[model samples]
Structures are given as C-alpha cells and as structure tokens.
Target: MEIWPAIDLRHGKPVRLRQGDYNQKTVFGDDPVEFAKRWQAAGAKRLHLVDLDAAKGDDPTANREAVARIVAETGLPCQMGGGVRDEAAIESLLGLGLNRLVVGSAALKQPDWFASMCDAYPKQLAAGIDARDGMVATDGWLETSSTPAIELAQDLRGRTENIAAIIYTDIARDGMMSGPNFEGLAQMAAATDIPLVASGGVTTYDDVRKLVQMQMPAAIVGRSIYDGVMQLEEVIEIAGDK
Candidate 1:
C-alpha cells in the first residue's frame, strides 16, 4: 500500500480541518511547497494535495499554482481534489501534470459531466466519496445526500475506461486521531472493483498496517503526521512498496 501524506492548502498555507469544518482548522505551515519537499525527503512516494479554499469555491488558481510548483520541484506523483467542478478546471489541473484528479460534488450534482471527465481523462480521474453517518456527503462535507456511499461507489464502479481510484473519506473520523473506518472501507471495497484509497482518522502506523493487511491500494494520513502522532518514515517502512 502507498502512504499518501496530505497537504491541504488554504490561502496558500498548509492546514487541516476537523470533520471537514472550516471553522475548526489548524494551520500546519506557511509554505506548502516546502512542506511537500519535507514529505518527499522523509520518503513519501506519493502525495495527497487538497485545496480547502477551492473546495468551498469555484476558483483555486493560487493553490493550483502551488501544487504545480510542488509537483515540479519534488517530482512526487500527486493526486489533488477540492474545487474541481468544471471541465476547464479539470483540464487545467491535469495540464499541471497531476497524476490524478479527485472529483466529489461534481459526481453527485452532475453525473454526466463526471462520466464525461472520467471518459476524457481515463486513468487520471478518481471519485472522492466523502461520507457521514452512512450517507454520501457533498459540498465539502456540509450536505448529506440521500445516496449511500457504498451504493454510489457501486454505481460508479466501471463508469470510466480507467478510473484511477475510489477515494473514501469518513468525515466523522477525519482530523480526529480516532482511527480509520475500516468496516466502511471493507464494504466499499467489496462494492466496487476500482482501486480503493482510504482517507481520514489514520493516527498510527498500526492503522496503516491494517489497511495494508486488508490489501487497500493506498491510505491518506494527515493530522497524525502533522501532529507527531505517527512518523512519516515509520509509516512508509510499514507500507513497503506500492
């Protein structure tokens, strides 16, 4: 399994939000590019970059530039999401050389557009299914849709010629150091054939080990690494080769 260290950008700074709440945020750094380099220096093979400001709005140009610079400088394969709602933005981000582009609300609000993007981008697109209380959450985890996350994943399983991955994030456990939602992940994995990437509440090396034992493709760890709960080097050693 690949360990994806997260770098969420808000106003060009690295920060993390609790349960996807913008009000309950913690700034991790002033320079996201430097932070990405640190993660690379610590043995990060893949990086997870998010634009918090973009998730809530339509424009993410600043964070997009920051992400482009990080990818250019560190040479780490990065997957980015948030504020990706249109074809132009998607095309722009992909033009930046991102390994994968994660789409959330667009998948819910505009299935046709989502399918078109998947078809257009092939293995360069991933569906970000962020859930709360068994229901799929959209609009940065602020709105809970009627569709269940597992069902959504099942519906989108083979919609794309090469769907890069299905990134499942448990909003309740995110940024809380509580541990990942393994049961939910197992169910989602069982529901879809696409590669699954677990996100949220990954607080320790054992958490990563659990995901690897389950044969997950990858896991995203944010707060744990930023807060010193888990060392990046140790987590990478545990994950081994992708």
Candidate 2:
C-alpha cells in the first residue's frame, strides 16, 4: 500500500487535531513547507494535505499559499482536501499541480455540483467519507449525517465516474493514537470499487502492515509521526518491503 504522510494546516501551520476538533490541537511547526521537505527527505512518496481552517468554514484562501509552496518546494505529488466546494476552487487548486482533490460534505450535500466537478476533472477527484459512529460527518466533521457511510459510498458510485479514490476517515479514531477501524474499512472497501485510501488512528508499524494486508491502495498517517511514535521512513520501509 502507498503510505502518505499527512500535513494538516490550521492557521497556516501544520497541526494535528484530536477527533477532528480544532480547539484540541497540537501544532507541529510554523512552516508547513519545511515540514513537507522533512517528509520528502524521510521517503514520503506522496503527501496528504488538508486545510483545517478552510474545512471549518474559514476562508478557503487561507492555506492556498502554503499548499502551493509545499507542492512546489518538495515537488511531491499532493492530494489535498478541505474547503474545496466549487468549480472555481477546484480549478485553482488543480492549477497548483495537486495530484488529487477531495470533496467531503459537497458530495453528500451538493451531489450535482460534485458530479459536475467529477465530469470536468476526471481521475483527479476523490470523495472523503469522514464518519463518526458509522454515520457520515460533514463540515469538518462537526455534524453527523443519518446516512450510513457505506450507503454514501454506494450512492456516489452511481453519481459520478470521475472519482478515482474513496478516502474513508474514521473521525473518532483520527488523532486518537488508538488504531484504524479495520471493520469499517473492510466494509467500505467491499462497498466501493474505487481505489481506497484509509485514514485515522494509525499508530504503529503493525498498522501499516495490517493496511497492506487489507489491500488498501493508500493510507494516510499524521499524529503518530508528529508525536514521535513512528518515523515516516520506518513506515515507508515497512510498507515497501517485499
């Protein structure tokens, strides 16, 4: 499985939030571009970037400059999410050479707009199925929807052919240092034919190995790396080993 070290930006800095809470945050560094470089040097193949501020209804432009710098400076293929709602926002970010752009709430709330975007940018789109207790979470994970996460993925399969990946994030597990929701992951993987990217609660080498065994296309790790629980290189090696 491809291992993506995450760089979640909040207030123009790299920080990890507990259970997707902005108030309970741990700032890793002030310069996110430098952090990108550090991940690159440590053998990151691709980066998962997110704008926490933007995700929370803040100005979408807040982290654009930082994101552009990270992509340009490290020259790493990045998949970014958060606050990308319209065609204009999607166009602007794709112009930054982002490998993939993820749409979370928009997929469930504005299916038509999301479908149009998928049609416009084939193979460049992904749907983020961030959930809390199996219900879809929206608006930076602050609100939970009655829709089952698996049902949402199944619905999206019929909505657009443009989505190249399905990023399933277990909000409760996120930044909790517990472990990924393997059962939930397995269910989603079974529900969707799109390539899957697992996120949240990944804590150790075993987590990487388990994801590989589960046949995930890619996995995103954030808090563990920042907290010194595991190094990026070590996980890369674990994932890459034959």
Candidate 3:
C-alpha cells in the first residue's frame, strides 16, 4: 500500500478541519511548502494536498500557486483536491506541475465528466468519495447524498480509468483522530475494482501500519499527522517494511 501523508491547505497554510467543518480548523503548520519538504525529507513517497478554502467555495485557484511552489521545492508527487470543477481548472493545475487532481463535487454533478477527464489525462486524476453514514457527501462534505460509496464506485468504473486512485474519506472520522474507519474501507475496497485509498481519522502510527499491512493501495493521514499523533519517518519505514 502507498502511504500518502496529507497537507490540507487553508488560508495559505496547512490546516485540518474537524469532520470537514470549516469553522473548526486547526493550523498544522505555518508554511505548507516547508511541511511538504519535511515529509519529503522523512522519505515520504507522496503528498495528498487539499484546499479547504476552495472546497468551501471560497476560490477555485486558492493555493494552486502554492501547490506549484511545493512541487518545485520538494520534487515529490503531489495529488490535490477541492475547487477543481472543469477542464480548464484541471489544465491550469496540471500545468502548475500538480501530479494529480482529485475531483468530488464535479463527479457528482456530471458523471460523464469523469470519462472525459480520464481520456484527456489518463492516470492524472483521482476520485474522492467522501461519505457520512454511508451516503456520499459532497460540496466539501457539507452535503450528503442518497448515493452510497460502493454504488458510486461501481458507477465510476471505466469512466474514471484515467484516475490513478480512489480516495475514500469517512467524513465522520475525519480530523477527529479516532482512527480510520477500517471496516468501511475494507468493505468499499471489496465492493469496487477501483484501486482504493483510505482517508480521514488516522490518529497514530499504528493506524498507518494497519492500513499498510492490510495492503489497500494507499492511506491518507491528515489530522493525526498535523496533531503530532503520527510521524512521517515512522510511517514511511513501517509502510516500506510492509
């Protein structure tokens, strides 16, 4: 499994929100590029970046330039999500050296867009399936839908083959540091052929090990990494050993 340490950007800094709440944000670091550098130095293979401000409808281009700065500085794979709605936005970000773009709301709005995106940029896009109580959450996790995660994954097959991965976030556990919802992750992984990646509620190095040893393709650590419950070096070593 690939372990991706997350760097969620908010207000131009690395921050994490409780269960995707914008009002309850905790700043993880002052300089996100420096944070990315720290992880790269610790032997991180990839960085999962997100723009919470853009996810909240603030600005589509928020921190994209910062993304470019981090990519240039660390020279590591950076997969970003939030505020990417159209072909132009994807083009702009890819031009900025973003390794991958993660799409959530846009996928829900235009299911056909996935095929077009994958066709245009194969293996350069990722799908984020954020859910609350089994219902797919959208619009920055503020809205829930009748669509279940597996059903959506089933629907997304082939249309999203251009996707490099699937980031499945359990909104209830996100930023709470309880531990990832492993049961749900396993279930979803079993349900779809999509290469699954876990996200949210990662609270310890133990959590990272469990996910890695389980061989789920990837695990996205957010709040725990920011709050010091998890360390980048330890996770990289553990994942490597597994």
C-alpha displacement of 177 in model 2, angstroms? Answer: 0.1
Q: TM-score: which is higher, 1 or 2? A: 2
**Could you tell me the TM-score of candidate 3?**
0.95
- Which residue pairs overlap in candidate 2's backbone? none
> TM-scores across all candidates?
0.97, 0.97, 0.95
Candidate lDDT scores, in order, read 0.89, 0.90, 0.83
Per-residue alpha-carbon lDDT of model 1 for 1-242, expressed as tens digits?
A: 88899999998889999999999999976889988999999989889999988898846786877888999999989999998899998888889989898999998777777888888888888999999987999998889999999888777764555678888999999999999999999999988888999999999878988998999988998999989988899998898853
| Position 232, candidate 3: lDDT | 71
Model 3 per-residue lDDT tens digits across residues 1-242: 67788888987888878888888988866789988987787778788899887888997667877788999998887899998888988998889888898999887778898768877899888888998988899999889999998888878784666667778999989888889888999899888877888998878878888887678787887666666777777877777723
What's the number of clashes in each of the models? Answer: 0, 0, 1
The TM-score ranking, best first, is 2, 1, 3
| Candidate with the greatest lDDT versus the true structure | 2
Q: Which scores better on TM-score, 1 or 3?
A: 1
Choose 1 or 2, whichever is better by lDDT. 2
lDDT of 1: 0.89
The 10-residue segment with the lowest total lDDT in model 2: 233-242
